[model samples]
Target: MKALDTWERVLLTLIALVYLAFGLGIEGFLSPYALADSTYNFSEKALIALAMALLVVAGEIDLSIAATMALCSLAMGFAMKAGASLPLMLLAALATGLLCGALNGWLVTRWKLPAIVVTIGTLSLYRGLAQVVLGDQAITGYPQTLSTWGNGSLGDLIGVPALIVPIEFAVLVVAGLAVGLLLHRTLHGRRLYAIGSNPIASRFSGIAVDRYRMGLFLFAGVMAALAAVLLTGRIGSTRPNLAMGWELDAVTIVILGGVAIEGGRGSILGTVLAAVLLGSFTFALGMLNVSGIVMSMIVGGLLIVSMVLPRWLRLLQRGARPALRTV
Candidate 1:
């Protein structure tokens, strides 16, 4: 806890305040079941944002993640309509994600294109494909298992009739823990920060900077696919509009998690906490029946503040340090 930076500490405190305030002010907000269920609203986005955190930390960004989700969901829907079983439908989605991720990675790494530009182009391409396939229609008929996994509670799955814990939330927590370990406990993670901080130096030091970038993008695709599956199941349909504008939310979660926009510095713990903080705060407002448009505005504002505030504070600290030395 002591090692946590200022931003992370702020996140923790903010989370506590959100929970406390909402619990007291909103009816049922503190109910165990309600708390668990609220997590469902943002679990998929948080899951993808975890993957997005890695990419942002490595000094690259993927604007096409939401589009990737749209395409993957359509792939699943198409497979299901063609009489594919549950596993096969899932495979279709994963395969689509794999191809999209590979393409994004290749364009950025092999062709020396800027990641932001590449992903933005692919974003349109992927969404265009989804729109072409969907075309003012919705796809449904997903298996019952999909619904159970998406909407059911852990208690429902395990036969605990009295317990009402959301399964999706549990999955998010597990995923967050795994990402934290990968970022903080592994050599591969170190190389990512090295490349992000200075790719030229890392390459000169024999680190495979391009390889890491490509791999990060590839993994981003898979996570986007997973999020797509969860979202499709939760909504019980797939459409061209699925996960639209979510790239902004996903990026907000990462940047708000304290990952530097320019790359090089961040922690998985900060990201997970940021997810919780954002989710809890939004969930509270949602209980008040706040408009989705307002929610999005808050998300956008938070993104800007998170990016700018820390740098400003750091500058103030540096100036204060020099004055202290003079004294």
Candidate 2:
């Protein structure tokens, strides 16, 4: 707990209060009606953001994650076309994601490429592969059980079954816990921060900075693959365009959660809160009949403000210290 700085604590508190107010005070915010229809969207987005937060903290980025997910979903669909069983299809999806992650890692670590550049290239490459696989078509008729897990909940209420706790939500919760541990509670987490703070110094201290970065990429890939599965379950189909332009959303959540863009700082809790806040805000805006364009602008503006506020405060403090010293 002492490890958390003042700003982090304050951000966490602020996000918590926002979520609480939105969840409890706002009408239709988490009502049974909205939960039945829109919980999956919030859950899926939250799950994806968890993995993304870790990637940003490690000083690496994976713009290809959404594409990786789409490719994996497409692979599963393609496998089913070839008469593959459910387990086989899942294995294929996981393998596709892992392979992409490894390739991205190899390019960045083994070849000394920047992660942003590598992932940006692979983002197109992977999505292009998905396009080739699906090509203006979608694969349907997945196993019934997969759909049930994807779209079904644990129990029913009156007539509705509580949106059936999305498999994506379960996966996201687990991933979030794992990442929070990795980033905040372990020696490896410390190493990651050290690497992010100063790669050359981390190397001198015997950390395999490149290897850690690669590991983070692979982890991000796996999480994205899981998100892909959840998405397939929710939609009950696979298409090349699935999860498109989602990288920005993931980045937005991380940044809004108060993660430092320069690296070496962030909180999974903050990310989770930011995810909820953004989801609720979007939903609220929609409920109020706000235009999608205006909603996007509001989100973009909020992100900019969140990022700038910390710096602005620091600048003010620096200016004030000179006057106080002179006095």
Candidate 3:
């Protein structure tokens, strides 16, 4: 797989220091149970981030993923209302996501439209459809098994109740690893990077750029649906607003991981670590009773800073190199 770079190393150190500070300063932050429970804050978001990372690496963006997730959750809710079994409900959710993604892919790839524009339109379209279906009502009373899967803990470790990892979080880890290997260890991944770097050049080099982009969109849609499954199970309810504004978080995680906004440069390891870092930061603020709006402001500030600081650093490096050469 891809090796870590200086930026990733700095992020890793920052994460370690932040965790240590919280563990030492907060009364219960170091407890095994508390540590495991905090994963709930970001595991679903991280799952989407993993897929979003690939899309971004290929020089594309999808603003519709959060809406796609909402629509998928509504599909599940309707399926349950119709007395569909869990397996069937799950299938319905996945199919809905795939269909939505295919629409996005077609609009962008086949119609030769801008991905940002196409996805933005679908973002509103999907969410509007969801609101129309539910219309100010929430669906509740999901299957007990689903709730258990979402909220239940693995058996205790070392006699610590619920100290083991959460099933949702474990799934995120497994997915992260799989994506990491795919992005870093496979030839398909190199094509994505090539396409991201320069689509016309990649095309000339025989890289089926459009096809890869479509596949990434398809993968992103499916991952968003999977996130909907986990989130619906955890909350035991569904609403049209489910996962509202989550696309921001997913993009933030990708950008904060040092993925170039223009694409063709980033690592899966960085995205994974960045997710944990952001998750921990958010959880710590929540523990302090921070307001949701303020927490969002913080996230926005972080995103802005993450984007600007790297450019400034590179500029400084360029300046220093000139000075050293003159010496």
Candidate 4:
């Protein structure tokens, strides 16, 4: 356990240091304004990626998370249109997300279908539903106070408002700590690991593998909902197309963070660092006026490299082992 903890910390530190270098490099070479604006997306997207990291670590994936977020925002928009209170709108958004999660979980568990298939079907289904709810209409003119949740930054420091932290950053930090603890310091977490590593063995060991998978899907759903709330507040509008393809971004970050896709092996610290790294990378590229297509290419290349390198290394070692035995 201690070794594993150390490894996790090491990986996180390595990513953090890489970001620090990149941040400074960009600051020295580029305009300060570029760095400042970059912080917003880096921070906001990091929060969304957190839930995705956890879901992947548990050996399941939710392709509909992006769609779920969009739907949640639509629900909040409907609530606002109905003159609902801010708190009530928040509840509606979260509840809608939970229901989406529960539906996905039920389909996957009850029917014993592959999660990828279930989520892919729901990804289109949920986003389609969001479009139906909004129908190319924009939900604008939300309450000013509610917008503050996403847009307000502390301006006063030392008798003056000086770059007050964004609420999204606070959410990211809190969510990171919570997820880190939940993954590292609980029996339920160990069970998740067991199930991910070997489902059959976990079942024989009396672990309720299906229940655990369902719970993870549910948790991810709620987190995605929370992300939607933040996004809606920040943008001051709800659109059905919001958060499209975010599921892939989350998966990229998870894999880049060193989470094994086959499950049973991963760390929250690594995922958090990878989230930050990816965000920083995107921001830096954007500052250079890189095309969106190029950015996507870079991200895709990284994901492929991260996934394949470890397996390639293992294969090389396996081949060497046979040679040694023959010798």
Clashes of each: 0, 2, 0, 6
Report the alpha-carbon TM-score of model 1 versus the true structure. 0.95
Structural RMSD, model 1: 2.0
After TM-score superposition, the amount by which residue 181's alpha carbon in candidate 4 deviates from its true location, in angstroms, is 0.4
User: For model 4, how does the per-residue alpha-carbon lDDT over 4-111 read when each residue is reduced to its tens digit?
Assistant: 334345456655665676667665523444444555675656666777776677778888988999999998988999999999999999999889999999998899
Q: To one decimal, what is the Cα RMSD in angstroms of model 4 from the true structure?
A: 3.9
What TM-score does candidate 3 get on C-alpha atoms? Answer: 0.93
lDDT of each: 0.89, 0.79, 0.89, 0.79
What is the alpha-carbon lDDT of model 4 when measured against the actual structure? Answer: 0.79
Per-residue lDDT tens digits of candidate 3, residues 1-327? 022236787678879888899888788987887888889999999999988899999999999999999999999988999999999999999999999899999998999998889999999999999999899999998998788667766653235564578878888989999999999999999998898899999999998888998999999989999999999999999999999999999999999988888999898888988889999988988888999999899899989988997677667666656454563
Question: Judged by TM-score relative to the true structure, which candidate is superior, 3 or 4?
Answer: 3
Winner by TM-score: 1
Which residue pairs clash within candidate 3?
Answer: none
Q: What residue runs in model 1 are displaced by over 4 Å at the alpha carbon? A: 1-5, 319-327
* Candidate 1 per-residue lDDT over residues 1-327, each given as its tens digit: 233348888788888888888888998898887888778868998989988999988999999999999999999999999999999999999999889999999999999999999999999999999998789999988898999888888878889977687878888889998888888899999999998999999999999999999899889999998999989989999999999999998888898889999999998888878888888888889889999999999999999999997788677666656454563
Model 2, span 1-327: residue lDDT tens = 233335556566665665567677667667676655455656777776777777788788888988999988988888898999999988988998899899999999999999899999999999998888678999999988678667766553224655455455566677778888878999998998887788888999999988898888888778777878778977899988998878877888888887888888878888877776677667766766889789778878878977997677667667756555563
